[model samples]
Target: VDADTPSACVVEREASTYSGNRGDAPNLRGPKRSKPDASSISQEEPQGGATPVGNRESLGQAGINPVHSPGPAGTGSQPVGQEAKELLLFACGVCSKRYMCNSKLVIHKRSHTGERPFQCNVCERCFMQLSDLRVHQRIHTGEKPYTCDVCHKRFNRRFSLKCHKRSHTGEKPYKCKECKKVFTYRKNLNEHKLIHSGEKPYQCSKCSRAFRRPETLKYHQKTHPETTAPRECEG
Candidate 1:
């Protein structure tokens, strides 16, 4: 039998049904059962006893539904298949986010704890994950691994390169909930949200003047470069 074959696929003896006619020595021999087709069997791991594989109703009763999980890193843009794969069981204590591996769960916990174990030697900046620290080191190394195919533009991060492609494609995925305004980047949509909320979070320290955006406050500070004392913003 193939290792991938479910235990339920193995042939089991069928109990013989007794005829209503006078007591014939209860047939000692049971009916022979044929083996199930391997192709028809589901590859999902069975829960509890030897329940028939590929039975969605049984799986639902056991609360064990097949779910797709992200494959190993650098597996490409396509989604990983759900066949013969284990579901994410390791969960974060803080947020209840699930991960397939325990190591991934350990790293995820750092987010809630604000723990950064990986440090950059050059600038002394800390990161929760080693991968993030390595990417941050690219600032000193000036290495842009990702490049655009259309414009030949280079970016340090793959995500930056992906966002740059949206500009070339004229794809504006982020939209403002207030006025139906669209933006190519999420940061632009976040900045536009300040206009609707009337929340001026960035304030000029010297002049006590507040602005909707940080860049506006930064530009406003140029006029009072001589002022060194920080003042509170007026309501």
Candidate 2:
């Protein structure tokens, strides 16, 4: 769906569920499964099939917030009922995740338990099914598996199919209550808090200098060699 949808639609339309290699070549040719019903779109059942999709608390509480988000000033939540039309699928292998469309499940079945019965001549990666193998072969030949609906980023994996929803929505579910700053990434939010506390856990051995991130410390150490040793100059 477009950015007009809910504030924390963290997952995208395609990647709601993952479809990996089934890990079975012999059983790959088994009977095809039926498409799921159209009315089945809801919070995914869960990974182990423990709670039914309708019963999950976190899926609803953390995802797809019903209320509108606070804008620059006094703007209210984006009205309810504005949702993207997503496809649906059914995973019979007893997994908790749900799919939006029927064809998706058919595609998803390829990735369970090593089911690559089909073979590609150009590359030896066996595919559980044909279409997936086609998608994979595109990799050796360098094909864009999927293009983003927004922005210039392209990915080879469909699991990476949907572009990061936060980029467009600008909804930072992970927030630092101490500073109240928002971050698109959870790790970034965690790092930002260090600024408030003035904490630098990562340190460089060569220069005895510190940095918030390891990369920064590594970069700073390079400057040590080019510049005169401060300790020697002082002596």
> TM-score of every model?
0.58, 0.33
lDDT of 2 by residue, 16-121 (tens): 3332433433343588877767555343455664545456465466554446533467564543432322222344465644567656665566566556678888
**lDDT measured at residue 204 in model 2 versus the true structure, 0 to 100:** 78
Task: Evaluate model 2: give its TM-score.
Answer: 0.33
lDDT of 2: 0.65
Please provide, for model 1 over 77-148, each residue's C-alpha lDDT reduced to its tens digit, 9 standing for 90 to 100: 644555323377787877778888999999989989899999999999999999999899999999999999
Worst lDDT run of 10 residues, candidate 1, spans: 9-18
Please list all clashing residue pairs in model 1, or write none if there are none.
Answer: none
Model 1: lDDT equals 0.81
Candidate 1 displacement at residue 95 in angstroms: 2.7
Task: Give candidate 1 regions above 4 Å deviation.
Answer: 1-87, 228-235
Looking at candidate 1, what is the lDDT of residue 74? 88
